[model samples]
Target chain A: MEFEYPIEGGDFTRAGMASSQVKKVLKQLNIAPAIIKRIAVAMYEAEVNVVAHAFKGTMLVNIMPDKVFIKFIDEGPGIHDIDLAMQEGFSTATESVRQMGFGAGMGLPNIKKNVDELQISSVVNKGTTVELTTYIS
Target chain B: MKLTEVVNKLELEVICGEDLLENTVTGGYCSDLLSDVMGNAQEGQVWLTIQVHNNIIAVASLKELSAILLVKGLKPGKETIETAIQQGIPILRTNETAFEIAGRLYNLIRQS
Candidate 1:
């Protein structure tokens, strides 16, 4: 199964809708609870990043019998330092975002932790793409 | 502790899923950070957060939480409530602060 969501940037409130739907779908599919939790966590982190950092973006989720794939593509001022951004406590979220209990710099790192494979590419002036895959078996 | 007792002691309103009030909750976690909640919360726990976003419901569902308490008198938006309802997660609204709710729930569950 496959699903796609348009993540509206700066709309912090609606950030986790995609991940929520994904979790529901996986549960209905009878996926293992542990794998479902891992995917949900990774997807939620990436979804939050789209709202907190990007101008706007899309989250694509593709599921198969063996693995699930998630891709986040955003049109924003891309990450200047991917390494720094990947650190656990290196967020640039505004005060408002911080007040909502996010932007503690754990987004990308958490995504990385939960996924089996994580690939990220970015250009300073253009955009960024994050690909995350989790094996079902 | 049963969710009903938490509701009674905390003086919270059941915004949705009143039928779930009798469900038992094993522990309580209070945090507005989605990632932290995702990482820390165990199954059957009650999540006490001041955040009213849709993702909060998502995290609770992912964690298999018994219910979610929106503290500090925060009212969730229509979309948030609808999503929680669809997920079958009971959401309660409380006039108490997150700290107060956490403390009271701790005492209540500890005694029980």
Candidate 2:
């Protein structure tokens, strides 16, 4: 099954809606609790990233028998240095965003830990695309 | 133990999802950082934090958490309560800080 969810940038209030919906679908499919938890965390972090950065983004989820694939595509001001962004304590979040307990620079690291495979590619001033895949088993 | 039991024992105020007070509490996690909670918190656990944004509700729901306990007398945003009600996860409040509440919750769960 495949699903697509739109993410509104700078919309902190509705940040994790996409992840929540995907979680519900996973639950209905009877996905194992451990697997669901990993995917949920990855998806939520990706969703938050888009909302915190990007002009807007789209989350595409492909659920197969053996694995789940997710893609987060967003517009503009892409990462200048992917390595730095992947670090545990590096973030470009504004004061207010950090104050909300988000933008702690743990988003990408957490995603990487939970997902089996992660690919992040970005063009400075252009856009970013993050692809994540996790085995269901 | 039921959520109501925790509420009564800890003197936590039920901010929303009153019907869900019957939900069972399997464990508890105390953290204010969204990523920490998202990365470490488990399902059916009661999350203790002072973060009062709507995303807290979103995280709790996504993680299938049983409930959220806001400490240090922190009040949740309007959207937070709304999301909690929508997600069927109770949003609980208390005057205690995260450390105090977490310790009490640990003892309560252990005793139970």
Best by DockQ: 2
Q: A18-121, model 2: which lDDT tens digit per residue?
A: 99899889999999988899999999999999999999999999999999999999996999999999999899998999999998899999999999999999
For A52-98, candidate 1 gives per-residue lDDT tens digits of: 88899999989988999999999998999999999988998898888
lDDT comparing candidate 1 with the true structure? 0.87
Off by over 4 Å in 1: B77-79
lDDT of 1 at A7: 95
Clashing pairs in 1: none
The ten-residue window of minimal lDDT in model 1 chain A covers A12-21
Q: Model 1: DockQ against the native?
A: 0.61
Worst lDDT run of 10 residues, candidate 2 chain B, spans: B77-86
Q: For residue A26, give model 2's deviation from the true position in Å.
A: 1.6
Highest-lDDT candidate: 2
Across B22-70, the per-residue lDDT of candidate 1 in tens digits comes to: 8888999988887788877888899989888776777788778999989
* Docking class for candidate 2: high
Estimate TM-scores for all models. 0.88, 0.96
